[model samples]
Target: MTDDNKIVIRERSTPSKLRYASQKLIEMHDQLIDRGVDKQRATLIGIALHLESMAQAAESSAGPNLTPGFVNEPGSTSELLPAEILAAIDVPPYLSTACDTALRVEPADVPDATGWARLLHARCRLNNKFTGAPCPCTCHGREA
Candidate 1:
């Protein structure tokens, strides 16, 4: 596209890192086209290579050990979910006992059924139907 046709993507004043990456992609595409690559293939290859480079940059910039548990993230950026919900979905033997007992416990038994309460709260938040209204579980509005 020409300068006049170039689309301006303004999102919170375009993050510097993102703008740099986008400009690099444009440069790569132009360079490949100059070297006689077909426009479609040049654009595709440029975008793919740029994405791989960005992912590698992010991975190397991240310091320390790989994260533990389900996410295996390098940092604390992963979404935190309740252990109760995790176990409930997988039904691990150890936590299954807790789940069974917790599930049977009354919702009013907050301390005793903390795990169950967490599972219910997580369910309410993650599922769209429940997000519109106050959760009917013990842990609802408690995250604050």
Candidate 2:
């Protein structure tokens, strides 16, 4: 597909939505572990889900003009959802931590059962989804 065809119109995520999504992630992780699922798979799922939520929340919170490449409907930026500023402030740190954790992993070892390994993989995927960065999704950023 051409670049135009590949373009996705993303909606900004609100702070309330972010919190709701985070809660959902915590629940998802707890349930997966509780259900005797593989820790690796469960962590991957949980992290992906959390990242998805974060993305949506970001869409809501990002100003219509936050990125120059995409177009936003007129007035969308000013008419933001009425959410607490403190809640909105969480996005940067949340994304930062997720990205940092993601960057440190070995793609091959990411699917391992160690703490947050699978989560790191999932975060990398989300990073690509959001920023269109070159993510191999194989957990091998160091070698590349």
lDDT for each candidate structure: 0.42, 0.47
Choose the strongest candidate by TM-score. Answer: 2
Best lDDT goes to which candidate? 2
Clash list (residue pairs), candidate 1:
none
RMSD of 2: 13.9
Question: Per-residue alpha-carbon lDDT of model 2 for 1-144, expressed as tens digits?
Answer: 344633222345455555555556566666767897765555545655665655554664464534554433221333333457535554331233344565565344543434565555544433332322343334544422
- lDDT (tens digit, per residue) of candidate 1 on 1-144: 466656443333334454455666667666766897654543444454445444544544454434323232222224445667555564322222223343466456443255343343333332222112222333434331
Please, what's the RMSD in Å of model 1? 19.6
**Cα lDDT, model 2, residue 142:** 46
TM-score of 2: 0.34
Candidate 2 — which pairs collide?
A: 11-59, 12-59, 12-60, 13-56, 13-57, 13-59, 13-60, 107-138, 107-139, 107-140
Clashes of 1: 0
Q: What TM-score against the true fold does each predicted structure earn?
A: 0.25, 0.34
